[model samples]
Target: MLTLPNILTLSRIVTVPLLAALLWWPGWATGYLLGFVVYSLMGVTDYFDGYLARAQGAVSRLGIFLDPIADKIMVAAVILILCAAGNDRFPPLIAEVHVIAAMIILLREITVSGLREFLAGLQVSMPVSQLAKWKTTLQIVALGTLILAGGFREQVWMHDLGLATLWASAILTLVTGWDYLRVGLKHMD
Candidate 1:
């Protein structure tokens, strides 16, 4: 259904490409700033979509299905774009070692998605956990901060803070990922 919540989620899925394009050029500081603004707006929409759905009792099956997909698509696009944007630069948006962190996050996302799909077939719902929520928050902040850092290239601290949170979020990602995998395996043959 095209409820307001569903509409908000749809907006996020559609905006991801624009977010990617904005981050395509790392040196375009102004573009990065604008990208940060866009990213923040997307995040706001993400929160409201779910909240409005719950508050209004308008949580349709379509909304549930599309919500996480939108989130994964957004995160994946941002990570891939940021990693790609910095490959040739001395200090890329996502540094060389930090790419490992990004990879970990990406791998977990794919693996969990598959696990969730398998569980869905069994009529089992794997709701997001508290720890996973924390991980998601950190991941968002890490990625957003990195984008913000791009706009203020001279503020090396922003980049450093971003990297620090990236690593922290990656660690949390592994923990929560394992938790999901453990739950998933229990349903396996």
Candidate 2:
């Protein structure tokens, strides 16, 4: 339960508040720079936790259950913080379209999480699709890029690139979420 891998996972959950604090203020270049570093470290821990769990063959029930929850919590927090910061600073840049894209991704995460819980209750395990994995990969990259861009806003192109990646990620998220829901629905009836 308190294995090294689990400890790494727990660290991510604990550090999210500090991450949020760093992203609280818009145009706080230094804050965003620190946030980017912390965020990247969190992402690294995310990878190592799973890798260590598998390598050590210490995959506990708690680790299995808490891993995805930790991921969702982190992703959701980042989205909310980015959206809030964007709104406060670059209102036009994070306007309706951008907000909707973020909302769509958030909604999909919640919906899929609920569906996964339901499927678990039904004793049906749903493996992640390749596309879903790709989506997650892209989503992480997109968010990381955006956070870095926030820290380096003097370079307008960086922000533009981040926003573009974000939209692309949102599109993939919708597709993958729908795929997961479709699979889950088949088991429901």
TM-score (C-alpha) between model 1 and the true structure: 0.97
Give TM-scores for every candidate, taking all chains together and pairing residue i with residue i: 0.97, 0.94
Candidate 1: 10-residue stretch with minimal lDDT = 86-95
RMSD values, in order shown: 1.1, 1.6
Off by over 4 Å in 2: 86-93
Off by over 4 Å in 1: 87-90
Worst 10 residues of 2 by lDDT: 86-95
**Residue lDDT tens for model 1, 1-189:** 899999999999999999988988887899899999999999999999999999999999999999999999999999898888863552578867889999999999999999999999999999999999999999999999999999999999999999999999999999999999999999999
Question: What do the candidate models score in CA lDDT, each in turn?
Answer: 0.93, 0.85
Cα deviation in Å at residue 110, candidate 1?
0.4
lDDT of 2 by residue, 89-173 (tens): 4542345578887788789989998999999999999888898878777778878888888788778888778778878888999
Error of 1 at 140 (Å): 0.4
Report the CA-based lDDT of candidate 2 relative to the real structure. Answer: 0.85
